[model samples]
Target: MNKSSVTVQPLRNTQTKIAIIGGGVAGSTIALRFAELGLDTTLIEKGPSLVNGPPICHLHAGGNLYREISDEQCLTLLQQSIETVKVYPQSVNVRPTVIALPKTDHGQPEDLLPRLEKLRKRYSELVSADISNKVLGEPEDYFRFYSRAEVDALVNKSIPSKATQASDWLISFANFTDLNKLKFPVLLVQEYGLSAFRFAAIASLAIERLPSCHLQTHSQVTAITADEDNLGWQVSTKLQGNDNIQQQQFDYVINACGFKSGEIDDMVSAKRQRMVEFKAAYVAHWPQCQGLWPEIVFYGERGTPQGMAQLTPYPDGYFQLHGMTQDITLFDQGLVASSLQSAQPKLAQRFIEKIDKKWPEQLIHNRTLGSIEHMAQFIPQFSSAIVAAKPLFGAQQIPGDDPELRAADVSFHGKHYARAEIVKASSALAAADAILANLSECGLITDPAIEGYLTEHYFPVSQQCSDIEVTERAILLAKQRDYPDALAKNL
Candidate 1:
C-alpha cells in the first residue's frame, strides 16, 4: 500500500526483467501474466490504486468479453473477471440488464424487425455457446422486444422528459446471483466502475499471488535502449519528486503506456510509425428521478461524431443521467450548465414533473450533481487517407505478364501504412478485449500478439478534416441520423 519513493539506482546486470508501464487494465493484465510466467516483473502506474485514484472507464466486463473479444478469450476473461469479483466484492459490480441491438426510431416495420431478429439470434448463439449456465424463459423474461410506445411509456415514467435520449429501448440482464460463486470480490455499481475494479483487483491478485512481481507508481519512463548482445532493453525513467534519474536493463519491455503508445514505439525500433492521436472529453451527470427510463439511449448520428446521453441505474435508489459532448469547450462548468439549460431546460424541471406523474410522497433530497471528468481522456484517431477493399479469402490469381501485378517493391508516404489498413473506433477496445481473452486462454503471456480487427474503416483521419467540413458533415449526418434525439427533436 506504500507509494513508490523517489530514488535513483545505477543499472545492474541481472536476469531478464519485464517492465509494464501504465496500471490500467491492459497494462496490469499483461504484468500479471508475465509475473505468473515466472518473469521478474515491474508494474509502473501513473496513478494510485483504484480505491484512491479517479474512476477508470466503466466497462461491462461481460459486454467487453462478448462483443469485443473472441469466443475462447471471452470465456476465459469472464471467468477471470468473475474470480476477481469474488475476491474483491467491494471493487466489482454487476446488474441484470439486456443489451439490445441498435434500433431506428422511425423505420420500415420490416427493416427494424430483421435487424432485431439478427441481434436476437446472435445473442442466443453467444449465450448458448459462451454462457456457463442456461435457463429457459420467455423472450421478455430473458430479453424482451418492446414497441416504440412501450419504450416511450417506460422512459416518460422512469426518466425526465427533458433529458436527452441516449438509446432506444432497454435490454436488461442479470448478474451473478450469488457472490460466493465468484473467486474475487464484487464492488458497488457505478458508472464505468467495473473496468477500474477489474484493473485493481487483477493487479492486487497478481502482487499477492506472484511473489516475483513488483509494482511501481509515479515512475515515468522517458527512454529505452536495446542491448546489442541479447536485443534486450535498458529502460530509463524519471521518478517524481527526485532529481536523479534511474536506469534499468531488462530482457524484454512491454509498452502498455496507452495514449503514449507512439512515444513508446519511438524508444524501440523505428519501423512502426505512430498512426493514431487521442482526444479527451468530459461526461456530465444529472439528478435521478423516480420512474426514470431504464433503456441505454444513444443520441447521435450512426456515422458522424455526436454527443451521447444515457440513464444508468444505481443501487442507492438513484438514477444517473450521463451525457457526452464532443466540444471540449463545453466541458467547463459554465459552458456545460449553459448548454444543458439551453438544450434541455426541462431536464432539471422534470424532476418535479416526474414526481407529480409517478411517486407523489417521495421527497427527493440531496440532489447531487457531478461530472466524470476525463473518464476516458483519449479516443484514438488514425492518420490514413487511403482505403482499400478487404482482402478476399482464398485468393490465387496471378497475372504475371501484367506490369501492374509485377512482384516489385512499392512505397507510399515515404513509408508503408501497412498497405490499405483501415482504422475504426472500436479497434482499440476490440484489441484489448482479445488480448485479455488470449492471456486467460494461454494461461500466461507469451510473445507480442495482435488481436481484434477493425470494422467500418474510415479514411483521411478525423484530424485531417477541416473544421468547416467536419462541422458541416457532422451537422448534416446528425440531422439525417436524428442524433442526440433532442437535436433531432428540435429540428
Candidate 2:
C-alpha cells in the first residue's frame, strides 16, 4: 500500500463540523476559517474572552514572529492577523520597533550598518511601492536603524528624558550619564501596546457574531475522544464553576491552547510533552509619561542577569518588560514544583529595578499588571509546535521530502489538529492555513469549490514550517553568574 495513494476518510455530509479549542489568536483564526467555509464551527474557551490572561505572550505582537521566521513568512502571518481583526481595525495597530544594542566589548558597533542593510533588504521585498504611508513610510521603511544622534533626536522629539542630565535613547545601567552605553539601534514591528488587547477583544467579537459559528466561553474542554461511529471526535467540556460536563461530537478539532495543549492531547493520546519556562515582568508607566515607543529591545552586558529585556509600551499607557530565564537541563520533576506565585514578585521586582536603574522616570509611579504566573513562559518542544491530525490515526508524519505535506506541521491523528506555543497571535493565521491545506491532503475534503477558495486564499510559505531552535541570546549561558536581588531566580 503506497502511502501517497492512501485512501482515508472524507466528509460524508456537505456540512463539515470543526471545533476550535482555546480562543486565543490561532484558535480564533481556525474558527473564522471554518465559519467562512460555511462549516459548522464552535469555539471553546475557558476564559470569558479571547484575550484571556497570562499563559501566552499576548503583548509582543508579530514582530517577534519576524525574529523567528523569514521576513516573507512574517509578513504573511501579519497580513492574515490584520485580516482576522478586520472587524475591529482599531484593535490592530502596527508600529515601528527599536532594538538597542548596548555597547559591549565583543562586537563592533559600526558593523550594524551592514547587518541592518541586509535585514532591510529582506524587508524591502515586502514593501508595496505604490501603497506607501506618511507615518508608516514604505513597508521597508518600517524596518530601519537609527544612530545615536538619530535616536537622541527621536527621543527628544517624542518623549524627552526629563532628567536634569539627558541620556541616550536606549535604557541602560545606573550610569546612564556614562556616554559609553550607546550602540546601534535596530527597529522592527509588532501587534503590541493596546493593539494586543484589542486583538483579543475584537477577535472574540468578530468570531462570536459569525452566524455559522458558536462562541462558547466559560466552557472548558475536559476530554476529546475518537468517535468510532462518526469517524470524528467527541469533545467534552465543562463550564467553569460547574461539575456537570457537556459533550459535542465534531468532524474535526483544533487545539491552539498554547501552554495547555499537551493536556488536551493527553485525553486521547498516551504521549506527554515538556515545557520550557521563561520569567517575565509587566510594569505600567504613569499615565502622564506617554512615551508611545514601539517594541523596544535592550541587550545587556554578557553574564548580567539583564542579558535581554524587551520593553513594550501599551496603548493604555503602560510598559511591559520581559527578562531572561534560568536554564534547566536537569529535569527536577522529582522536586515539588515551587509555587509560581511566590516567585513572581521576585521576578517583577527584578524587572522593575532593571527599568528604574536605567530609566527611572517611567516607573516613578506605576503598578504591576496581574499575577506572577503571567510572567512565566512555558513552551513545549518546538518539534511539536504545530501538528496536523486525523481523528484516530494521528499526525501524518510522511517520511522523506514532500513539500505539500511539509507545509506547516499538518499532523493528523483522528481529525485532531494542534499548534503548540502560539505565543504571538500572528502565527495563528499560518496555523489555520496549514490545517486547511493538510485537511485536503488527508483526503478528508475533496470539494473543488472549497479547494479553489483555499488555493486562492492560501498563506504563501516559501519554506517548510519548523520550530525555531535558535535561542535569541547566548550571553545568559553563564551558569554560576549571580543575579542581583531584583534579578534573582524565583523559587
Candidate 3:
C-alpha cells in the first residue's frame, strides 16, 4: 500500500502568532522586531513600563571592562553595541572611556595592546563593509594611549567646551585622578555610555506605534500549558491588583523574563542550569566639579575589598558610581543558582523587596557613601560628592553558573519554545534575530515580504522617534521611576 503524502501547510503572517513574556530589554527588542515585520505579537510585562530592570549605563562596544572575556566575545560585543546605538541613537552618551590600572592591580597596561589592536582592525572591517557602520568616529582613532607625563600636563589645561579629540575628553579625569597611583600609558577606548531611561523611552515609543503588537503592562503570568489541540501553548496571567486570571494562546512562546526567565523554564518543566546576581550603582552629585568627564574605570579584583570602581558622568553635575566590594555594590548571598528541585534560582527576600519596592534610606546611604569613598582613593575630590538619589539595582541572570561570562544570546528548548538568556542589553537584537530565524526554520513565517525584509536589515524602525521627543519622554520616565532626571539625559 502506498502511503499518502502528508500535506503540510505553511502559516501566513497573520495566522502565526508570538507571545513574548517579560518586558525587559530582551522582550522589548523581540516585540519591536515582530511588530516591524507586521506579525501578530503580544508583549506581556509585569512592570509598569518596559526596560525597567537592572542598571544599564555602559555600552560595552569593545567589551573593555571585563579583561577575562575572550577576544571572540569582545568582537561580538562590538557588533551588537553598534546595532544597539543605531536603534537608539538618542540614548548614547558620546564620550570616551578611560581605562586605568592602579599600582595595586596585577595586570599590566601592555597586556591590553593586543586586544585593542584586534578591536581596531575588526572595527575598520565593519566600517569598510558599510559606510554607515562608522558610529564610533574613525576606525583608526578607536583607542589612544596617554603617558603619565601627558596626563600630568593636561591637569592644568582648560576643559574643552565640546570634546572633539581624544585628549579633549581626558582633561577632567587627569585633573581629578591622583597621578601617583596609576600606571603609565593609560588607555582611552571608544566604549561609550548608555542611558537606560532613554533606551526604555525609545523602545516603548516604537512598540506603541505598531498596531500589530499588543503590549500588556503590570500583568503577571500565572501558568502555561500545551493546548489539547496540539497546535499552540496556553498562557495564564493575572494583573497586578486583580486575582482573576486571563488566558491567551500563541503558536510560539518566547521566555524573555530576564533574571526570572528560569521561572518560565520551570513552568514548562524544562530543566536548565543558571544563576542570578544582584548588583547596584549609586548616584552622586558633585556641584563643585567642573567640566565634562569621561566614563572612568579603575580596574581591581572582583568580590574583594578593592573591586573595580566605575565612575559614569551625567549632565547637571550628577554621576553614577559602582564599587564591587561587598559593602558597596555587592551584597551577602546576592548571587544564587538553580538547584536540583527547580530551575528557578532563589534570590534573598531582601533583594527581591528592593526590586519590587523601594530601598530603605539607611541602606542607600551606607552603600552610596561606601562607593564615594572607594573612588576617593583615586580621585580625592570625589569624597565631597553627596548621594543624589536612590541606587539603581536589580538581579541579572547568568547562564550556566559562570558569573564572569559576558557573551550570550538565545537558546531553544523545543520546536515551539525559545528562551533568551542575553547577558548584556547590547545582545538583545541579536537574540531577536535568532528567534526570528527559528520561526522561519519551523515553517511558521511564510510571508515573502517579511522574508525579503529580514535578509539585509539591521534596523527597520531606527528613525521612528526624534531626539527632542525621546529626551522629553525619557526625563519624565526617570522622574516617575524615582531616579534623578539627569540619569536619563546624556552628558
Error of 3 at 337 (Å): 1.0
lDDT of predicted model 3: 0.87
The 10 consecutive residues of candidate 3 with the worst lDDT sum are 1-10
lDDT of candidates 1 onward, in order: 0.33, 0.43, 0.87
What does candidate 3's lDDT look like per residue over 1-491, in tens digits? 01112121222555888999999889988888777766788999998998987789998998999998999999999999998887778889999999999999999999999999999999999999988889999999999999988888888788766876679889998888998998989999999999899888888777767666799999999998988765589999999999999999899999999899989998888888999999899999998887878999999998898899999999888999989889898889999999998888999999999998889999999899999999999999889999999999888888897888888989988668999899899999889988988888888887765566565443445455788878888999998888888898878
Which window of 10 residues has the lowest lDDT sum in candidate 2?
Answer: 386-395
User: Against the true structure, candidate 2 has what lDDT?
Assistant: 0.43
What would the per-residue lDDT of candidate 2 be over residues 383-449, giving only the tens digit for each residue?
1211111000001111112211111322344444544334345455556767877666655566766
lDDT of 1 by residue, 120-165 (tens): 3544564566452222122223334444444334433333333243
How many clashes in each structure? 38, 21, 0
* TM-score: the better of candidates 1 and 2: 2
| Candidates ranked, most accurate by TM-score first | 3, 2, 1
Those runs of model 2 whose alpha carbons end farther than 4 Å from true positions after fitting are: 1-13, 53-89, 105-119, 127-136, 152-179, 185-194, 270-278, 287-292, 301-304, 315-317, 325-410, 414-421, 455-491
Work out the TM-score per prediction: 0.47, 0.62, 0.96
Candidate 1 global TM-score? 0.47
Name the regions of candidate 1 deviating beyond 4 angstroms: 1-16, 50-92, 96-142, 149-198, 205-209, 271-295, 302-306, 315-324, 328-491
